[model samples]
Target: MNKSNNKLNKIIDYIRKDNGINNAIEATEQASLLLILKYFYDNSFSNTIDKLPPFSKVFLKGYKSHQSRNGTGYLTLNNIFDERIKSNSSFRSFKKLEEFLALVPFRVHSIKIVEVILHILDEIQVDESLADDYDNLIVSMTNSSISSGAFHTPIALVSALVKVSKPNKMQRIYDPAMGTGRFFVESQKLVKDDFLHFRGNDLSAFACLIGSVNLLLNGICIDNINIEDSFLYEDNKKYDLIYSGVPFGKPSDISKYGHEYHDYKNSLEGMFLKHTMDKLALEGKAVLIVPDGLLSNMTNGFKDLRYQLLTHFNLHSILSLPSGILLPYTSVKVSVLFFDNSPPDEDVWYYDLALNKNINKRTPIKEDDFSEFISLFEKREVSERSYLVNKKSILNDRLFNLSIPLPTNEETIKFDKAQEIAQLNSENLKLFSSITNYFDVTSRDIKVENTDIRTIKSLGNLKTGNNLTKSELLGNGSFPVYGGNGIIGYYDKANRDENTIIIGKVGLYCGNIHFSEEPFWLTNNAISLEIQDTSRVFAPYLAHLLRGLDLNKLSTGAVQKFVSIKKLNDIEVSLPSYEKQVELSNYFNELEQAKSSLDKLLSSFNEGISLLNKNIILEKVIN
Candidate 1:
């Protein structure tokens, strides 16, 4: 992968160095064309010479026929005398009888770019899936260009959609906004029918050319590829399968296409929705990734569109997708809708794929991520993340809002109430028992306890933390920096080195206390407690005892909470034996661990309840 990426980078860098290339998008477009032409030409150099473009054939014959012993496949820029590439024609076209060819590199240092292209092809031939590596290269190279809004849909999403559609070789598949033709490419891997017809349309001429090459490489014919705005391009042919994830944003001059739509003006996605629906054959299935607003947007256009979907199409499934699926482009939340041009159904199965992880360019969505969703989809059974909803209940005033209910649970309401009652009662009994034991222990050692009742100042040294700014708390650091809330970030320097108890000195977390075992940098929001002598006191025991005190009541300031060092030092406390302190500290550690576990369990339980509510609440209306 590294070698393949390196070779791709070399080609893109060469394109970038060319004075004629204006932006990364143009570089990607040129690189894609060059890579494909080189791949086919290099495969059968002698036999394919006649198939090359006019000037390209002469250039390749001179470059390849040279019997160089030394392995430098560099060519001179002076040899590229092709005027057709610079002719006044669309980048993908040539007038009269001229054939198309990517413009040759113009920079002096781009002589060896052909070698890099050949290296990339070598890696790809070893594993054909590496063609996706080329796709990634194009996406990364073009990411900085303002004109580049087309992103190849993540392969995982394409695979999931294709599986759900259950495409057969006999069926005709179409993608209206086919960026690099990824949907068609991925579908070809699943559909085994040799006679499958693939068709696509896109607004970008470069995208159309790339999609054509990509489909050809993936063993799919590209006879039906159209380079026109799908919204305005009327087609009489019907398709058995249609899948698209249109660009999510406000489109330019959509009002021009208003006459073609039922509603005069709507979002780009809304227009595409109506377009695809009209193009579906009888009993044809279509899956689309649409913005979440489409389900509930109050505009008359969206309302009418949703009503049409339910009235004319069988809207079977709605899958709420996680955000960042199209990262570096748009973070808008989207959902997948699977509907057939058959009769409308009474119930719609909704799945909230609460993939809680964040996705980005660095971390992409993968095929395995859809495994569980596919399993649940096949079962068609309601689970924590899946539910069934009635069509009529969602049809409010003919608006047809299809937003699925967020997950929650009402069956556990009585259980929650009973647990709360039991928790409160247990706390009351434990408090009573603790106070009884405290009084009994102190009363017996009345004389001895009086000698040990010293101020906190004598028990330990309290030091205020050094102030650290946000900038200083980042980078490759060794020690964690602590603020009131604890471990705000990391820094290279340490102000203290000891097993110390951290006290929240100010703000909302003023009364909080935390323990640290390693060297750390500290901010002024907290103070550290370092005991002078451990034989007389245990650090953990003191921390637990201090935490039990009413420190919040002692806090000052009306605007923001604060605790002074003097107030903390002046507090008097009875001291237990060193042995008893150790015992109590160990017990406190166990108690803290147990509390942490219980907190996690409670969180998981709440999540389960939320998921349950999402499905069950809709049952009352859907059934």
Candidate 2:
């Protein structure tokens, strides 16, 4: 963490220590806002705290009264607070200033929060983006609602999206899901023209307040920062450049959108996609982060929405972000969809930024990580990480799944090397065929053998695993601890030692498959598998076979999806003889090895192709 981050965390910690504040989130938010307001006023009137906003003036009066040894100090503070709530709506939320008093405990400690604010203020200097200084605090501390689907957009991502859109002073901008207005502030910093106008809307009241303060302190007006459900709000306003990180997997309330919500409004992100398309001016451009499921979901509404996007807009680019970018919030993979309200294009570009970085809340992402992507993106050039696909190919795919496919291992092999290998293999095949032909090759007639079909329960035992809470995860234990989404952490002890298949039994990753060859601890969220007759069926082969089954489709659970053992047992599978199972397992293992080697080769080819492209571009440079 940097210096500013530590200071903000210190303030949050101090405010959270107050027992009087029943809602710690609300209290921290209010205090953070108040401290920021004071800093804003102090910057304007450095000599004294007077002439500040009416709200600040009232708070200062209470603080001053407590300092003096004259009257009932605490009572005097309550009187000022009561007066402010009656007069100001912003103060209404923080009705009991006593809670704040509790946070400060000692009247002398009043300056502690103020000092932190000032330190933050100093960092938000000429060149610093507001997000660069305060985004971490705003995101980490703000409350998250699953229904709202809103999460803090990383500052690095916000900045990159803003740059990608290339916001100008003359153009209008908007962020429908603008939490804390990070996008708005970043846009303001990039504006080179004289006139700049942007609109922001969010359903969360706390977000609106925090956003208002963030914009105000950044020297931007907050007149258009509306605190309303953007989906319900009616407006015909169009923008030249727009960007947003829409809530992922949230339900849409179509009741508010009226007839406009008739089609795909059943889907939350689909509704956001439609809304953005409708709000964009002719030839206008937009970049939004959407859940990857939206691209692949087979829902009628989602499919229609995908078609609508490709037909009505120039679906120019899709940037696939790897898992963990939104960690501590969601593990769902997301993509940045860049499109314009122009005629549909013949080809769309895609970039894969899934380059092996394990991003989490503790280990944050930096702008430099996106430098190569941004550089390649700005030039609209194809690299190992980027490619262009034909629109017709997308139209042919099921549900028009716009999810860009990264280069396969085979595709990554250079054309020359691949061709040479292909020729060699072709020659070898012909020679072998000639030898067999010369030897009078023949096929022996054999009867087809039938294998018995059996349910999972008939062949094995399935039971829920042990519970390994996030708090108990030591991370440095001797054995890997498996969860719904695979190894979450490590533990000191192993629960099971036999080779088995772990099936995600609960949550978003329900039905997901993970194979463990060594002893490991499995979370209760998943089901541990132990084949009763391993000689008849290889464990690895069964694991691979189970993986082919669409388990996610059978998942149950309203709030949290789950796949139960009963459901697994109901699905019948073919069981082969012991000798056949062994032979098949060996064959599968060889195929896996081949696939792994191909992946490595493809990865290398991708790197080589990218290098070649970059060199070609450099050679064309005038300098």
Could you estimate the TM-score for every candidate?
Answer: 0.57, 0.57
Candidate 1 Cα misplacement greater than 4 A, ranges: 2-6, 19-24, 39-57, 60-130, 138-149, 192-195, 262-264, 411-623
* Pairs of colliding residues, candidate 1: 390-622, 407-610, 407-614, 408-610, 408-613, 408-614, 409-613
Candidate 2's residue-wise lDDT over 105-207, tens digit each?
2222344454443354444332133345565556655323221124367778888888778888777888898877888878888874354788888765556
lDDT of 1 by residue, 1-623 (tens): 67766666776777777554545665676666555544433333234334434334444444554425323433332333245432423322222111222222222223355455444444444224446667676567535532354546777888998887788887888888997888887787786555678888887556775666676556666657776678777678899999898765556466667476646354778878888898999999999998887876657888788888887899989998888877766677889999999999887888887776888777878888888789888666788888787777766435467776644655322235456555555655655555555455435432223236768899888888987766777866899898876888989889987688888887545768888888898888788888898778878878888888857667864223578899989978767787777766776666666555555555544444443333333544543
Q: For this target, which candidate reaches the highest TM-score against the unseen true structure?
A: 1
lDDT of each: 0.68, 0.66
Candidate 2 segments whose C-alpha is farther than 4 A from its true place: 1-7, 20-24, 39-57, 60-133, 139-149, 192-195, 409-623
lDDT for position 470 in model 2: 65
Total clashes for model 1? 7
